[model samples]
Target: MTLAVCGAVSACADTSNTPASQRGFFGGIGAAVSGSDERRAAGLEQSATDAERKKQQLEARLGAANADAARTQVQVQAAEQRLAAVRSDLQRQKERLAALRAGSPSGSSAEEAARLQKELDALERERRAAQDASTAVTTATLRNLEERTRAIGVALDRLGAV
Candidate 1:
């Protein structure tokens, strides 16, 4: 009777075949729970990787845009300087023309002076055309740079929100 009772108790407490890791309270529950946890962790990791990649790409584009803007600024400055010089030269030529007109010369010399005046006028017109073109180009470039900067700023704002 005692042997029979011991056998019954031992059979009821059967844990010898169970793996060590699965021998705790609610141990079998880990199999289902661990699968979900692993999937969640993997998803979070992938999201982090994607966000980082996007951030790096945005930063690269911003850097390139800033460099382009800097170069454009330098070019605009150079154009402005050239335009200023051309205008200064035109003013000086105007002053020389005025002085020549005031001091009337003899017949042949007057003809020579007239030819010189015509050449100076043509040069002035060419310089004015060049200045106008340079100004237009610089204005357009600056406007483009400004718009690009605004776009980059908006992109950064969107990225930060993400």
Candidate 2:
């Protein structure tokens, strides 16, 4: 009887010909659990790869922007320098006109004063044009740079959150 009982137990335990699910209640649980874990791991890996690609793209854009900003800065500086030179020339013309008017009250002196006054007027116009150009360069370039920088900052922030 003991031998018969042992045979019955061995038969029940022998699962070589049984499908995994038919072997027992927990027979296929490992495969199911491991499959889900593998899928989750693959999903996480994909997300990481996407994030890294985005970061590299953003960095490239930032490098280009920085180079553009540097160029714009140089342009602004040149514009400012030109404006300053125009202003200096205008001041000198004004002083010369004042001196000519103050020197002699004769007819020839009056003619010379008028000529200087015309020259001064032309210089004033030149100064105004230079100032306007400088202002335009500063406004447009700086505003564009500011917008680009803000966009980059936002992108970086989003990447960090991810």
Candidate 3:
């Protein structure tokens, strides 16, 4: 009776720690076992770590892009202010020239007026060019920032899914 009990107890004992090849067909004494579960857990951990690292990198990129956009905006504002100042100066010069013309007409008055008009025209052209250049630069900067923002957003979304 003792021998039969021991045999039955040993047969019913758990063998999850034993290699599948070594365990008999009756290895179902306990829950199923394999290295796959542990490997899968480790793989999941690695994937999660990679996702976190990617998310952090994307966030850094987004921060840098935002800073650049802010700096570019400041530069654009300064340029616009400079253009406004130039336009104001041009207007003042025109008013002063008109006052001088109204006060007198002399032998050289026609020539002097022509020269002043040409100078005013040149100044206007210069102001227009500067304004256009500033606008172009601002546009390019905004476009670059927008593209970077979109790319970063996509990367963040992928990280979230992961």
> Estimated TM-score per prediction?
0.53, 0.50, 0.59
* Candidate 3 lDDT tens digits, 108-146: 664665566576666577667767888554545434433
Better of 2 and 3 by TM-score: 3
Q: Which residue ranges in model 1 land beyond 4 Å of their true spot?
A: 1-34, 106-162
Q: Model 1 TM-score?
A: 0.53
What is the per-residue lDDT of model 2 for residues 1-162, given as tens digits with 9 covering 90 to 100?
966654555444544344555645433343343353456568779999999999999999999999999988888787787566556655754665565456554565566556556755754665566567774655554344334434433433333333
Query: How would you encode candidate 1's per-residue C-alpha lDDT over 44-161 as one tens digit per residue?
Result: 7999999999999999999999999998878767877755655565466556555655666557656655665565566556556656676356555434433443443343333333
The alpha-carbon lDDT assigned to residue 57 of candidate 2 equals 100
Q: Note the clash tally of each candidate.
A: 0, 0, 0
Model 3 pairs in collision: none
User: Which ranges in model 2 have alpha carbons more than 4 Å from their true place?
Assistant: 1-34, 103-135, 138-162
Clashes of 2: 0
Indicate which candidate wins on TM-score: 3
How accurate locally is residue 100 in candidate 1, as Cα lDDT from 0 to 100?
57
A best-first ranking of the candidates according to their TM-score comes to 3, 1, 2
Cα displacement (angstroms), candidate 1, residue 131, comes to 4.9
